[model samples]
Target: MIRKANISEIDQILAITKACGERMKEDGIFQWNETYPNAEAFQKDIERGELYVYISEDIVLGCIVISTIMDEEYKSVKWLTPNSNNYYIHRLAVHPKHQGKGIARKMMDFAEELAVQKNFVSVRLDTFSKNIRNQKFYKARGYKQLENIYFPNQSEFPFYCYELPLKK
Candidate 1:
């Protein structure tokens, strides 16, 4: 089941992110590390009621943040969809041990459904340029790749922005 994340789940959420980071590093992907997606970020996300977690058998398998707020950096991109009334996706993470079980896909499905219900024009997100798997995943879901954005603290490489238009 997917539901809003509680503050108490922060520890499990952090663990999932940590495991995911370790797994990515093992595969030579430096998308996440000790800095980005830290506890503070998740805490703020929870406080804002934007963070959602995927649970199974009482375990927090994954998490995703869907919000109407976009970062200032997004304003610089020439997006395919209009800026207003859009949903921005962030911190999409699935535990390595529970991966390949379609948890991430389900979370995305939930997010998109919520977007449609909220009359959002599109769903916007970013993927690490070096993470080919993630890039392909979003592209396959019809997310159009736009220009790149940078998170200097996370990696030297730029992150690619993507948008999936919900309205014609």
Candidate 2:
């Protein structure tokens, strides 16, 4: 089941982030390297009410961060429509052991439901260029790709933005 992340789940979230970083490195995914998604960032996200975790049988299996809108850093991107309340999803991580079990999809479904409940018009997210599987996955789920955007911290790597309209 997916639920709001509490302070106690921070360590597990960090472990999952580290595992994901390691796996991505081994697999040549270029978004997260040695310095991204650290514990401090996760702590900030949790404190800001943007973190959510997927749990199963009392074990955390995945986590994601959602926001009503992105920071000013992403304002240049044209993917996300300028609306008062559009949901933004970030840091979507699934435990390596529990992958391939449709957990991420379920989490996404929950996100959309939340957006609908909140009366948001759409949902937006981004994926690393090297993460081909993610691009395809999001595409299959009705998320259309926008222009590639560069991260100031990692200018060498670019990310593909995606958006999905939630209006029925």
Candidate 3:
């Protein structure tokens, strides 16, 4: 089940984030680090009602943050879709054990569904440029690669943004 994340689930959310971070490091992806998606971040997400979790029988399998709020970095991108009606996806992760079970796909479907429901024109997100698996995943889902933006604290390489236009 996919639903809005509550502040009460902060521990589970943080655990998921930590596990993902460790797994990424093991796989050589430097997307999240010691300072990212921390407790405070999740708190703010919950307060803003932007965080969602994928659960199964009361166990948290993954989480994602969907919002219309654009980061200053996104402003410089030459997006194919109009920026006005787009949703931004951030900190999407699935527990390592729960991966390969189509959890991420389900989450993406949910995000797009939410966008349509909210009258948004598209979904926008960025993946670490070095994470080929993520690039392939989004590409296969019809997300168009836009341009690269850097996170000085995240990686030496740029993060590539992708946009998927919703069917009218």
Question: Which one wins on lDDT?
Answer: 1
List where candidate 3 sits over 4 angstroms from the true fold.
none
Give the lowest summed-lDDT range of ten residues in model 2. 73-82
Clashing pairs in 3: none
User: Per-residue alpha-carbon lDDT of model 3 for 1-168, expressed as tens digits?
Assistant: 999998899999898989999999999888899898799988988899999999999999999999889999999999987779789999999999889999999999999999999999999999999899999999999999989998988888999999999998
lDDT of 2 at 110: 91
Over 15-132, each residue of candidate 1 has an lDDT whose tens digit, in order, gives: 9999999999999999898887899999999999999999999999999999889998788999987779999999999999989989999999999999998888999999999999
lDDT of each: 0.94, 0.85, 0.92
- Best of the two (2, 3) by lDDT: 3
Off-target runs (Cα >4 Å) in candidate 2 are none
- The digit string of per-residue lDDT tens for model 2 on 82-157 reads 6568888999999888889999999999998999998888899889988998999999999989877887675477
TM-score of each: 0.98, 0.93, 0.97
Candidate 3: 10-residue stretch with minimal lDDT: 78-87
Instruction: Tell me how far the alpha carbon of residue 147 in candidate 2 is from the true structure, in angstroms, after superposition.
Output: 1.4
